[model samples]
Target: MKKTLAVALALALTATACGSSDEQDDKSEFAENGTFVYAIPADPGELDPANAVLGATNTVLAFAYDTLVYSDADGKIVSGLAEKWEAQADKVTFTLRKGVTCADKSPVTPQTVADSMNYLSDPKNKAALLGVLIPAGMTATADEAAGTVTLATKDPNPFLLESMTAVYVVCGEGLKDRSILKDKTSGTGMYPLFTSVANDHYAFKARADYAWGPGGAKHEAGMPAAVQLKVVKDESTAANMMTTGELNGAQFTGADRKRVEAIPGVRKGSAPDGIGEFFFHQGDGRAAAENKVRGALVRALDLNELRAIASGGDPVPATRLISLAPDPCRGDSVTGNTPPADPGTAATLLDETGWKAGTDGVRTKGGEKLKLRVAYQTSAGPGVQAGMEYIAQKWKALGVETELVGSADAKYADSLFKDGDWDMAWVPLGLSLPTQLVGYLSGPGPDEQGSNFAHIRNPGYEQLTAEAAKKVGASGCEQWTNAEAALVENVDVVPVLRPTQLVASKNAMLEVIGGVVRPTSVRMLKN
Candidate 1:
């Protein structure tokens, strides 16, 4: 049996289930070949898998790259580039499948895969997936004759194999010159980049000989000969395209969901993306740097109302940070862990902390005013924008001066990692394993080339997670749950709601694994 992790990011807000339509049961035949067109929210910057972070970039990369292993919708590890794999606490070995070739027609060798891993593990390379997928300081070795690549880490990782499912393998050519990947493909996926028009659209040509897909899936009858992704920023516009047959599939998470659900003959389904979390920056001089102020600010907002507003309806209240399916640790660490909604208590806490209300109704501590710059991703849809605005309104009522800053994915990343201008941010750090979150939650800040943007220093969380990492797989679930509870209890971060992402499709039958359209699972229907 193989261990799995739910680490897929929701790409372009859409994914299709195994059974995309009720009519598929009745109809056994479909079109032989056609183009499958879909919509993405923004331009996928830097096609190199190592540097790709934006969900849109991942969506495009999904069609052009393959991982060492494949994680199904059910969170099961299956064969991908590797025919088989063995994972232990400190190391993992992958056996390459025969006849695998890169988009450039070069045969994929074990050394090529090892070089990709080695590149990501090196800090000097500055790959975005450095610690997220390939652990920092990890090393890889390849045996050409045996056709195997083994990855070893000094620190033990129970979920090491699960994390490998997210690393996109780059071929030798792309590794030498990454600029080629910016506008093209250099991987061993079913589709290769054929044409790219930046923010407008991207087209990929299907490889007829490609056979190694998730769980041995292959190109079959009715599979799209080509795939095209159009940049459609507006949900209503994307939904309209889906209805008019301009788009084969699209995802809606906001008010446009109702419109997509009403379109007849469109196959629809839902998946758990991740929790919409509020992370307070603990950097010096920030208002939220004070623990009492953080608690008071959280208490001022009605979480129930905010969840409804953010999700566009009643959503499942997030129980833990891992909202994706098949969560190894099934426990509610968020409930009864956060501060309750009590404006009076919030005001009292602020008053006790020297944040007294002034003549302008804004709280002031010493001589400085209580001000916060709240940030969010504008591309997260209108619900998120409204949710940020709602927080600002609630904070204003609590006499805390607030400024809401919303930007696209690239700009948002720059704000959190480069500029460091935000006091609090409504960012969703989605991951399948608790161990994978250690760097983002505790390690060095962005200034030190680490992802701990919040700069959280919860000693209890670090201690608990360290103990949990020593154990293997599910045995450490209890400590992991307790660690998350400690973070919530300390008001270091707030888990709000887990939104059910809705996807709809027309004239196409396909399956989405790990929030990406499995290239071989797509089957075109006759118009």
Candidate 2:
């Protein structure tokens, strides 16, 4: 029987979902075109949800896996693998769907979902970013008879389901060997990893024996047949590939948007989030790494020029450590109206902090040159290099020496991050959950299995985040407000700008969901 109710709901949303566009010529490489080629900025660093936080990796892998719950375009949580859930008192019960299998042909179970969340919650795991999604003392349990799983938390976590999107469920068969994720990913998703050409491309084949998709899902068990994600890091190449029909969809910057749409058979749409920026390292023992200096650095940046160099003129300067999504962090309330970019102000701040300019105009304090070794991840691409160099020049004017390091290697970058070799760095921080920002502030940072990349620890800031996590969602307003205020008070990490991510798709493609906290099931219809 046709699910008329589900179809009607989808049709209702079509008004907002259907994007306006100028048609472009569509080309393809498949036999009668059963394959779709997608282009993104980077390759999937890892398929493991517990470790892999890159947008490209998650976006491509989402079709290959299923999570406990799903998030909508507006950052709201809805049901996914689970049919329905009941939250009673302090315990929550989740009813699982039937006949689900992993990509490797393993059965899905309540234990599987619970085990996956547990794995992500473990502190011993270095790459687990999902740990910050939940409260510190939450336990997950499985009930076989009811096909349900229960998560008991010490306190209320209204955004628990929203956080579950990051905890994508996997096969429970090999829970002991976590290394299976490094090579193979097992989940009850639409696509399975058929081939992965590292740094080049990856191929996913639709599961023939698949079932158990939610009612709102656009695609059923196996709709696309085969999904291909190509790594065309260059914007021009990706646009060219999309035009020639070698690729069906690609992520485009604001700069590429005009040119991409100018070609026939292509359309451009905006992703609902903000762009990434340079996260200044302001931890202990670093000379002149004070709040005044951090604020001064932000003032020195020509945000207009930065935005011009970036995809669009949309420069949402990160006034606070938190993201630009919520309106509470904007305007003169946090960052005073017109941030001062005066070199005199910056030099004066450094001078008062004991840093004196040498003969070379580079400041020094205690016989140590005030040159900061700003190391941006080599994998950040050429556009990032250009922006970093521009910022480097701006800092030089303030008598501060800046260094730009490039490499596509994450391991090498991880080594630098661990050893604290970077004075200031351009790192992509995944701040989906509100607490994730707090975790980056005072919790055991990424280097210590926490998100605190700045390695900043303040008791006051830590308390604010802790209090906020106790009540998420609408109720978390006070906690988040206080925490955000505390973070900005110190100016521990100066937020350069928030980015509105860019995604591109073929003319035949029906829809592309943007601003997703975690990659789930996104469908491209046969338009």
Candidate 3:
């Protein structure tokens, strides 16, 4: 679960370009058949949807696989593999669209979708999206005659249908032999894997016969004949490539954003990546285990300054946990809910909590010096590094000895969950639905195969979320907002900033849904 969260977080940080639909309606402005080339930060190692945990892997998977359901730009559930779906508290039923076929020309049956769901639901498979997308202990039953797949969960899931949008259904053959999926595509998507060159590029050829898409969208004249995702690690290089027409689309977040935006023919857009949040380790034997200590830690640092530094001077105050597009609940749960930045108050709180400053300026409680290990992902770039350093300096002034631990994306999850080496971490868990975050904010720890890495045990949060789960979809948003406020008020997690990621495109217009390029939304324009 830690690895899964880490990989998903990487997806949130890396931005992708999208375009408007104004030019999409004109068939004369469209290119009949041409390859659409784009940029990805890293090579998606394995192509298997079930085993994919890296953002790069998921990015590639999105091109080759189609989910059970599709989430439109407005966060509405639309047609995909399943034309229509009915979601209940503990049960969800999907009616499979007729005449759907996999990459191998195999028929995509209700049983096929059921098998994929059951595979992820089973803990023995060890798929990364087990509890994240597919609910834990979920079972699926297929009614082939009715062309429907029914899912049953042990506990009620309010966003059951919305969650299905993330589950990429695997075909029967791929389910039997998972190794073929490592580098090949097998789902009923618009494209199939054509070629894969590790660390270089992964190419996909569009399925001309394909007609079913989100909201019954079909492969038309403007759609690309093939899609190529090139691995370009440097943001500047990607931006430069976009300028020269070498790449059709690419996302830039660093200093290269200005360069990409300056391109004459390129179309640019922005999307909310996620919140720059801080999570305190509430595990036993940790100083942050105390609520007052957590509050003091939050109060010690100037969040506004840190937000500016972290977002590279483009800071947006985060209100809710669901920052990504098509967010079901858009209410503000952050304002007036967290502790304000006040060094004096922080010192006083720490002193009141029995921590007294010594001659060396480091506070001590019961002969133990106040020390903290702050961990953050190095791949988050220089801005995050500066932000983490800024927090350390502020804590140092507050008489707290702080050690900054910078880990790469791959090792960040282990540092937080497996090793339990850090006292606090700056890892943003982004999701479209607030119900999806319930597990991460409160629940079992890593040892119990749960995503609550911080080991946060807030009764108020748990109770509010429990009630929120009972309500269906956005109707429970008010309770969900209050639930998030509980975490903020308790200092369980501090959402500091919401950063906007920029993406530029040339000769192509694409739509970014849930922070990824929607394949069906790609329209190659005539240059």
Every model's Cα RMSD, please?
Answer: 4.6, 8.4, 2.6
Model 1: per-residue lDDT, tens digit, 1-527?
A: 00001122222234322223233463746787699998887788778888765667877998989988877766677888999998888898999999998888888999999998998889887777766667768999999999999999998987777777777999958977877876777898899889989889999999988988877878888889899999998888998898888999876777788889889888877666677889999987787888998999999999999998888784669898775423567679999999999999999999999999999999898899999999988867778888988999999999998889998866777788888999999877667667767777887888877778888989999999999998776778899999999999999989998877666778887665555566777788876
RMSD of 3: 2.6
Model 3 stretches astray by more than 4 angstroms: 1-28, 172-176, 447-450
Better of 1 and 3 by TM-score: 3
Model 2 gets an lDDT of 0.59
Looking at model 2, report the run of 10 residues with the lowest lDDT sum.
Answer: 9-18
Worst 10 residues of 1 by lDDT: 1-10
* Residue 145 miss distance in model 1 (angstroms): 3.7
Measured by lDDT, the strongest candidate is 3
Please, what are the lDDT tens digits per residue for candidate 3 over residues 1-527?
A: 66556645655666322224233244448887889999988888878788765556767888888887887766777888888888788898999889988888888998898888888888998888876677789999999999999999998888888887767889957877988887888887888889989999999999877877788778887899999999999888898798789999976778888878788877777766677899999898899999999999999987889999999989988888776545777789999998998888999999999999999999999899999999998878899999999998999999999899998866887887788898989987777678768778888988787778899998988998999899878888899999999999999999998877775788888877665788888889888
Task: Itemize residue pairs with steric clashes in candidate 3.
Answer: none
The local lDDT score (0 to 100) that residue 474 gets in candidate 1 is: 74
Per candidate, the number of residue pairs that clash is 0, 19, 0
Runs off by more than 4 Å, candidate 1: 1-28, 103-105, 172-179, 285-287, 323-330, 354-369, 407-415, 418-420, 446-450
The models' CA-based lDDT, in order, is: 0.80, 0.59, 0.83
